[model samples]
Target: MENANVLIVFVSAILLFCIAFSRLITKAGIPVLVFFIFAGMIMGSEGAGGIYFDNASAASSIGNFALCYIIFAGGMATSWKSAREVLLPGALLSTAGVMITAILVGVAAHFLLGLTLMQGLLLGSVVSCTDAASVFSILRSNNMNLKAPLAPLLELESSSNDPAAYMLTITIISLMKSDGGGFFGYALMFVMQLAVGAGLGFAFGFAGALLINRIRLNSDGLYPVVAATIASFVFAAVQLMRGNGLLGVYIAAMVMGNVKLVHKTSLVRFFDGFSWLMQILVFVTLGLLVFPSQLRAVWLPALVMSAALMFLIRPAAVFITLSGFKYPLKAKLFVSWVGLRGASSIVFATYALTEGIQNADTIFNMVFFISLTSVIIQGSMLTPVASMLGQLDKEDKTLVSRSFTDYEEDIQGTLYELRVVRGSKAVGMAVSDMKFPESVRIMLIKRGESTIAPTGKTLIKEGDTLMVTTGKTEALLALKERLALV
Candidate 1:
């Protein structure tokens, strides 16, 4: 009981500190994830806190669960309209680009670390995927709005490429274990994983959306619960069928996100916050699993591999895979530099460790070092690099400017606060009865201590605070004057 209490207190304290410290870190132009991991390291056994934790299996489990939501949230937040523009290129980067990167990094590792082809490939595959959390964090933190398709391209690639890297990692591990699978067998497995995952993802996503819209639950809060359940179920079901669960979750989210559903704005907000919490949990847990002291042994090789990945391997993959596309040289170079390996790599490395592969500890240490350095270096330089490449979209402010839902038209407007005063004609009237301007939207209603999503039938009581949005400044002024008359 005492131990459990201590554990609770420690975990909560760390979360509080991270939450409080995040704003400052973001302002400093550092990746918040780096700070989350560093916090875990500070509280580890070798650090001042002396909390001993070395559970690879546990870390893997937590990481997988966190990644499911993170990916789903990312997919939900993505705009299919924007994503479709870069679909072909993004697909190549997520699939062929990942494979090429893994192969190149594998070859480099084979030479640099004196490892076998398979072992080197295993290490390469572990860190192959560009982390969604890291990319999203850095881009959003820096408020970077890349020019045209670059932002969507990078976002799509990072969120979707994990399944490919995961497939590679698992395949390499199985081949190492059995020494049996030929090239044909490996290719077949990879194809099957993607096909099954994509098929089931589309099926479940549409089905889930239909179910949510048709089944009108009593409480608004339960909508997000249903969505959460669907996200987890899709992942588990896909994995059960030997498909790529991560891919399934992401595709499922994208499908559902595009479809109209209940309380979508609230649901998006909920999942967005939940995914951030998950990222913190995953990073901290993985941080606790590592001993910083062990990293020294693999530091040199890790540094070399990290440099190769950033400069040679990632660039080659981007340039080669994107050769058929019409992207400019600056765009390709920027994409290459933005490839920041992060929590996902360490999570995949944990899987390798749990499987008891040869030199698993060394692989984990090397991956940890590589991920840390990649995030710190590439993450910090993202804004400057984008600026230098002339890719920054100065006109756009939001990371995701497009709407993900069918109902929310034009999310890029100015928000206004309006209060319902006593004796106002609008009081005791339903929101639908107001006949507000078409360009205006009632986003939220704050009544006393409770906030409400104002539906058409919702009554506008006196003393209610309405959070509204207008597409133009003139529309906002018109709304206020009209509200005063009401």
Candidate 2:
């Protein structure tokens, strides 16, 4: 027990260092998630740290929790206005499209590697869903514009596909382990899982929101904390009822995020950071759970499966499902390329490991390798590749931007004051001329706090709080780099 604290501290320190390093390399477009996991591998039992952790149960639970945070955030970030146009196609893709991808990959795996149909499908199902965190983060970060409903379609696709893939994976694993099970039984199980999960998630999410709306806490911060509990409870309740709790959580959060609620910005910020933390932990811990030595044995088969997935299976799946859709070749190509296997794949591997399935260790290691390769290769190139495919461009600002009124947002901005100093470069320059990096918006310079509005002609003075709206980091950086201000 005494050494436990020491181990925790050591692991935590490694995580912090990896996170810092990841941030430093964002310019290279490699996601921070990839870095966190790789750092875990370097510190694992096979590596220098000599930490042997084969606790499949523990890893699975953590992975599930991490996925919940991710799904909730994805839902919150989605806009109803944008989501409406994509709903029809999105549903079709999540249900029908996911099945198609799984089948194609399964077929390829069977033919190429001579694996059984079920085994092929399991591998296919594992990587079918586009990673929710990776998709949302990259799309928003690059400000990639989709053709009208197409953006929302992809967002919804990524958000909802997890449930179906997860169902298939679990059911197949069960059937494999069972003495016997007919086709009708398998179908019934799948339908039951989907219906139950959706029903429970909706009920819990709606009820939670109703309860939360009435609770006027002393502090506004309580709202987010309450919502966090709501998310977890909604997921747990659904899972306990033999439903797809993961899917339920996402739908519930999407509804909540779109509701007319107070403190929206604060809520978004809270979830964004929370989801990031979850992703870091999920990826890193999953990495440590893998043993590198067994990986060599699985190398041949894993690579065979990967090639079929990357080239043959994914493209076939995309083409079949998108048959009637108006998506261009570029969008289709980009979509096929970005079908990453991240947290969910790792979780599925955990499932395989825990069930005492055949070759579980080898499968886990193989998956860990594939996930690393996919995220680093596909994840790092998402922006560039999308840009090349004409699906994304650097000139775009953001898909989601907030509009501010003269009073409301401005009044809020004044609370975070910005000042123009005497002899400051901004003094003589026209508000537009100085080219402020969208950080500070000049509101009003006060000779005193009584309220004096600054017009376009307003001059600057030292020791005056400029009453400008600015991004915290941006404002500080601007002051240091451009104005030499403290």
Candidate 3:
């Protein structure tokens, strides 16, 4: 009981400190996640706090649990309408681009770090994907608005590319354990994981949406609980079937996000906050798992590898994979620069340590350094780089803000007040009966200074001033037509 209490207090302190410190450093242009990691390191056994924690299996379990929700939240937040425009490019970037980057990094690691081919490949695979959390944090935090399609492309690629890197890592581990045999068998396994994960994801997503919309739970809060349960089941079932659970969870989320469900606003908000908690936990846990002294031995090699990844391998992969597309050179260059490896890479590295692979310690340390460097350097420079490349959108609108289902709130679109004229068609009609477009929302209504919190059943009245908000000009125009104000 004493130990448990101490544990709780320690964790709460770290969380509170990280939260407060992150806000203070936002203007410094450093990624807030870097502080979460530093807090863990500062509290580790080697640092001032003297809390000893060195269990790889525990870290791996916690990291996987956190990553599952992080991926799910990302999927739920994605807008299908926006994603559709860049699907093909995103697909190629996530798959072929990952493969190219991994292979190049693997070759470089073999030559530069004196590791065997398979071991080098394993190292490469661990850092292959651009982290969704890191990319989303940087883009959203900077209030970045890239030209059309580029922002969506980057989001889709980061969110969906994890499976490829994961499969490659697992496959390489299997080969190393089996003395580099069974190449064909592992390739077949890789393909099967993706196919099964994708199929089951779509099936579960639609079913979950239908259940949420029809169940009509007694409490609004229960709706988010149900959605979380469905996500858990989807991930567990896919993993049990030998499919990639991360891919399954993400696909399921994307499906549910696009479909209509009850209490969607609350659902999105719940997962958004929950995902942040998970990220903090994952980064801090990873930070606690490492020893700063051990990193010294691998620092030079890790630095070399980080440089190669940031400058050469990532750009090559982006350009090679995106060559056929009609994107501007500046856009492609910006995309390549925004390839920030973060929590996901560090989490993936824990897999190697748990599996007891050769040089696991070295691999883990190198990956940690690489991820830290990427986030600090690339993450901080995203805004300036985009501006230099001429990719920043001058318009106030941002792709990150509009990427969610509840985008009107994020966009903070124009608000209009129009008094209901006597005998207007909208008069005496319920707000629900107005049939406002999904993009438009009635904020409130005022009649004779008696403010009304408008509900679906709230009736419009003569001389009532309606406060309306919407992000879409077309939706606003349509609402005007419906109210006979145009």
Which RMSD values do the candidates have, in order?
Answer: 7.8, 7.6, 8.0
Ranking by TM-score: 3, 1, 2
Quick one: how many clashes does candidate 3 have? 0
lDDT of predicted model 3: 0.86
What's the lDDT for candidate 1? 0.85
RMSD of model 2, in Å? 7.6
User: Candidate 1 lDDT, tens digit per residue, 374-462?
Assistant: 98888878888889998886654334333122236346688888888877778888999988886788788888877665556678888
Report lDDT (Cα) of residue 173, candidate 3. Answer: 88
* Candidate 3 lDDT, 1-486, residue by residue in tens: 998898778878977887887755555556788898888898899986688999999999999899889889988888888888999999999999999988999999999889998889999999999988888777766666678878889999998899889889888888898965688999999999999999999999999999998996678889989999998999999999999999999999999888776676778889999999899899999999999999999999999999999999999999999999999999999999989898888988998999999999999999999999998888878888899999987753434555433322243688888678866789899988988887777876777846665656677888889888877888787677767752
Q: Estimate each model's TM-score.
A: 0.84, 0.81, 0.85
lDDT of 2 by residue, 1-486 (tens): 878888788888888887667645554555667777777777789987778877999999999888888888777776766677667767777888788877887787778767788777777777777777666655554445544444666677787788888888898788888888576798897899889988877777677777777888999879999999988988888888888888899888877776656666577778989999898888888878877777788788787777667777677777777878887888788778867767778788788888888766766776777766776677678777776877753333224221000111223332355565566666555444555554566555555534445444345556566555655665656654586443
RMSD of 1: 7.8
Query: Could you tell me which 10 consecutive residues in candidate 2 have the lowest summed lDDT?
Result: 401-410
Give me the candidate number with maximum lDDT: 3
User: How many backbone clashes are present in model 2?
Assistant: 2
- Residue 321 error, candidate 1, Å: 1.2
Residue 184's lDDT within candidate 2 is 78
| Displacement of the residue 46 alpha carbon in candidate 2, Å | 1.7
| lDDT, model 2, position 379 | 68
